[model samples]
Target: MSTPVTASADALHRAATRKAMLRLIPLMCLIYLLSYLDRTNVSIAKSQLAIDLGLSAAAYGFGAGIFFLSYALLEVPSNLAAHRFGPRRWIVRIAITWGALSAAMMFVRGETSFYVMRMLLGAAEAGLFPALMYMITLWFAQEDRSIAVGWVYTAPALALLIGNPVGGALMQLDGSFGLHGWQWMFLAEGVPSILVGVLLWFKLPERPHDARWLSKQEADLLTARAVSSGTGGGHDASRITLAMLKQALLKPFVTLIGAIYFFNQIAFIGLIFFTPAIVQQMHVKTPLLVGALSSAIGVGSVIGVLGVPRIQRWLQRDCLLLGLLTFGLIAGSVLFLLVPTLVVRIALLAILAFFGKGVLTLYWTIAMGRMQGFGAAAGLAFINMLGLIGAFVGPYAYGLAESATGKASSGFFVAILASVLGLVLVPLLPAALRRADAEASQSQRTSARVMTADSPVV
Candidate 1:
């Protein structure tokens, strides 16, 4: 009888996990793909935007970077709102507002309007990633967390891989309604997010318990997993207190995660904002060709994000994998500077994408493992907010380098230096995270004992 029960439980777990993945991951991927494209499509539009607005490289960079300022500032609050209101409604709100703001880019007629619109768009999109991370924590178990994150993260790479060419093609509609190609791209891309946000209202559940598609057994199993994993399903997951927030903020691992992410974004965001310019500097003149080549180079990011699970098995250590990735970023940046051939340059960018974007899942998985409940919600947002300040710095620094030197490749110096700084910090992650995990386990154990003692006897 006991054996039968054990077998039954195992079968249910497997079936439920499969269903959860099917219902959630693809939609999550689609949402992120749209989100990423809306934010970074400015890159493909840079040349024309600059010409029309009479903006220099530095000014354009400043405007692009300003988005992150508003984004980072509002990230924690936005996430807290999502945590309180339920991600189902909050995420929809974020999506619709951001989509509208993004579409409004079509109306920016000057540098000032450009900066203002970009910042508004940033504010609207703030906390979307952390909210999604929080949702994943509520849904996935510890062992499967990284794999789920990898799949969701692949969407950004896919956004670049697919959206680039689509954007270039849409740009061809520049004069269709007397709007510029860039304007057309913005309007076309932004509308989908709004439609998708509405669809999510009907499709997405507030929590595992609320999932109508899941059988009672599956929902119970998932909720049990969430509670045991400290991901928050019961009373403990309810409200984040002042002490909890303070404690999370003071953790060394949290600080380290923020620092490492900051440095990494300097390279990753720099690449996103400058890749087309870098390609154009390589003498790829046409917008269509530039988009095609940029998309081709983005293939490495897709490979890197999708390969995390297998790569984790091969590496057997997140720290080691992280070290290797950062080193790869450094090597690729150095080579991109040394190599003048167009093919080699594109290849180096691909390599950079591999290492730069690949590190995201590894680091996020590590961070998420140590957080649970509303703490996970607030903590993820805080770390993301702190780290993304570098996103601002990255574009502005690269733009300054480009403007000062009149050379696109000169901007790579920022990437190289930032990656090296991140590498130096990699050695600290293991110890910090280990300490955090141990503390979290002890707290979970204590909570379990308290709940067990309070339970009514069968």
Candidate 2:
């Protein structure tokens, strides 16, 4: 702690890491923006698409949530493939495939075709999120991870902020080239994904060691730091045994981690897919206004994302903040039901958005802190895999609930239940994090971990 020369080298590492984050985060974020745009633009297009194809509300919601089924089915295997091929290649494959399938939605003339296309898109895009999370761990240190992740998470918000207005505009292209406006919108939004995928082939490096922008010193530093951060110590390509996988499988924290994300994603999924419907039901029919309202939600999400690091910096107790945020989310959900005024509903939605985004953003920090080696990848992926079930449940159940209740926000009751489930799981986290932190610290100090090649991700 007192050596000037050693301190200077430490300073150099931090500077290099920050600079590298600036370089990498934008590209990563842009690719994810494309991913979110393709998936969620369907939300923007749903009203038009339902009318054009004669889909019932339940059918539309079914189609939307059905995407996650295929996503869940393929998630682990796709992540396993990405871990084997490297993100540079695997991500490009995911991108082009999902984009092509998404664009093909222009041909969906019935419920069957709509469901089939959505499922295909999910299969094609399965591994991108978890792979990105795993990659973040590789490139950024524990200290800088929140910043890198914060920027990356904002892409989804940006997608909605920008996508809604733009998708609304594209919706005006109805009947152009004998296609419905929703068809044109789907095709238009789908193009960027293919373009982003192509760019990534040339732009994204598989790892720090492969990055042209990094010097040898920087690359070595990052690689060393990653290994030291419970990445199986030094065996980056080591094989994981059945026993290791079984042990990771048996961790109670793994189930709790999945529950946290499950609740967070379900809250968001209900909002993302059904907000337009909710707005329109309130007698707000102008498409542009609808899109703008959607952007308001994005504004809330962005604020929440950016605030995570800042609040952590200020309070220095992220776990406490996480607990508070979880409770806040439950309160927001309850208010969503009781609030009747439009303005108040808007504010409550924003509050819900804020807590929803914050919890997920901060959650992985705890998750990663507790996990190590091959099991970490599995832990992350399994969390993602199970989380998609919540994604599936949120929209599908919302549609059912909306139909049953005969009110737009009525479906929010289901979201409340999900969030409550998540809250109940909260007390379990601290003790679990303690166990994980102890395990991770011990693993790092003893250099006793081994990285599993083909370690599947979320």
TM-scores vs. true structure, each candidate? 0.95, 0.93
Model 1: residues >4 Å from true position, as ranges? 1-3, 233-239, 444-458
On the 0 to 100 scale, the lDDT of residue 54 in model 1 is: 82
Q: Compose the digit string of candidate 1's lDDT tens values, residues 1-458.
A: 69999889878887888899999988888888899999999988889988877878888888888889899999988998888888889889989999999999999998899999999999999989998888898887777788889999899999988777888788878788688999999999999999999998888887788898998989888777766676764224355677877876678888888888899998888888888889988889888888889885569899989886679867779889988988998888989888899898888888889888888998778887777776788779988997779899999998999999998677789998999999999999889988888987797799899999999999
- Once superposed on the true structure, which residue ranges of model 2 sit more than 4 Å away at CA? 232-240, 441-458
TM-score of 1: 0.95
Instruction: Report the poorest 10 consecutive residues by lDDT, candidate 2.
Output: 231-240
Candidate 1 local Cα displacement, residue 65, angstroms: 1.4
